[model samples]
Target: MGLRYSNKINKIRTFALSLVFIGILIMYIGIFFRQYPIIMVICMILGLLAVIGSTVVYFFIGMLSTKAIPVTCPSCEKPTKVLGRVDACMHCDQPLTMDRSLEGHDFDESYNSKKHSKTKA
Candidate 1:
């Protein structure tokens, strides 16, 4: 199979959305434990927490979007936000990098890590 790639911000947003669905599913499951009030309550609370956490994550991503670098994706010819040193274009999921030295190199997420950069230096 080919490598699956997507915009980092989009990926995080998708995760947050999935968390909301999972939280709702968990809460629904809790309804079956009507005889065990404690278990049901606990499950409901956990589910609520997950949903709330997802909201917080969504908000955080919004704040981060403002700070992300804006660039035109060569492959897509569309403007997109880059979250880190390396990121995919939001429009086309085209891999991109801000570092000229890494230009034309394979898309490696590790390039953003300090350990990997230090080793190269």
Candidate 2:
């Protein structure tokens, strides 16, 4: 199968959502350890931490998204946010870039790295 690309913001959001689900699953599993109060409590605490971590991640991503550059996707003609030098269109998954020099080149996420930019210069 070919490599699949998705918007960075969407990917992060999905990860956060998965974290929430995982946290819930862990809490559910803890229910089976009712006889062992220590184990159950441990599991419950871990699950709570995971859920809290997900909330933090969501908040961080939301803030970053607000600062992202807004642009209309050429392929979809829909407004989307670009998180870095290179990102996929949220609506159409079209490869995008903010730098003219990098245009037409392969879409590489490394372009967003400071080391890459220094090397290019």
Candidate 3:
């Protein structure tokens, strides 16, 4: 078995989308507790919070993505955004790196961490 890698921005966006679905599911589940007013209210409130959290996450990622470096993927020749030192091409799964020292190395998400870089140095 081999590990799979995906674009960080896409991953985050997927997570946010899932959160919206989860929030809706929670709210739907609350409908069954209509007889228990307190429990129903609690569930509704929790669901609302989850949806709100998702909104915030979407907004934050959108802002962060705007700051990401735009580069053309060598494999696909399509434009994509790189979030950190190492990120897979958004269009193709080709591993990419901004640091020359990291070139030719196996793809590892840990390389994006400050602690990992410090230890490597």
Candidate 4:
């Protein structure tokens, strides 16, 4: 199967959503431990923390969105946000890059790493 690439912001949002679902699932599982009040309380508290963490993550993404560069995807002609040196078009999954030297090179997410920048230097 071919590899799938997603926009960075979308990936983070998905993680935040998963955290919410996981938190709910944990709380639901705690219902089975009704006989042990201590375990139930612990589970409930942990679940609440997860839900709160997700809220923080969502807020962080909102802040990042403001800093992200808005560009029109050439392939889709749709406006999208690019978060780093390389990002996929949100609408079309087409890989995009801001670095001219990296253009036409294979799309590798490692290109965004500090090590990659040092290599270029």
- Worst 10 contiguous positions by lDDT, candidate 1: 1-10
Clashes of each: 0, 0, 0, 0
Give me candidate 4's TM-score against the actual structure. 0.94
How do these models rank on TM-score, best leading?
2, 4, 3, 1
Question: In candidate 3, residue 69 scores what lDDT?
Answer: 95
lDDT of 1 by residue, 11-91 (tens): 889999999999998899899999999999998998999899899999999999999999999987989998878888898
Better of 2 and 3 by TM-score: 2
lDDT against the true structure, each candidate = 0.90, 0.92, 0.91, 0.92
> Candidate 4: where is the Cα deviation over 4 Å?
none
Residue pairs clashing, model 2:
none
What lDDT is obtained when candidate 2 is compared to the true structure?
Answer: 0.92
Give per-residue CA lDDT, model 3, range 44-119, as digits (tens).
9888998999999999999999999999999999999999999998877788888888998899999999987887
lDDT of 1 at 111: 84
**lDDT of candidate 3 at residue 112, scale 0 to 100:** 96
What is the lDDT, from 0 to 100, of the residue 42 in candidate 4?
90
* TM per candidate: 0.91, 0.95, 0.93, 0.94
Candidate 3: Cα lDDT at 94: 82
Candidate 1 pairs with clashing backbones: none
Runs in model 2 lying further than 4 Å from the true structure: none
Q: How accurate is candidate 4 locally (lDDT)?
A: 0.92
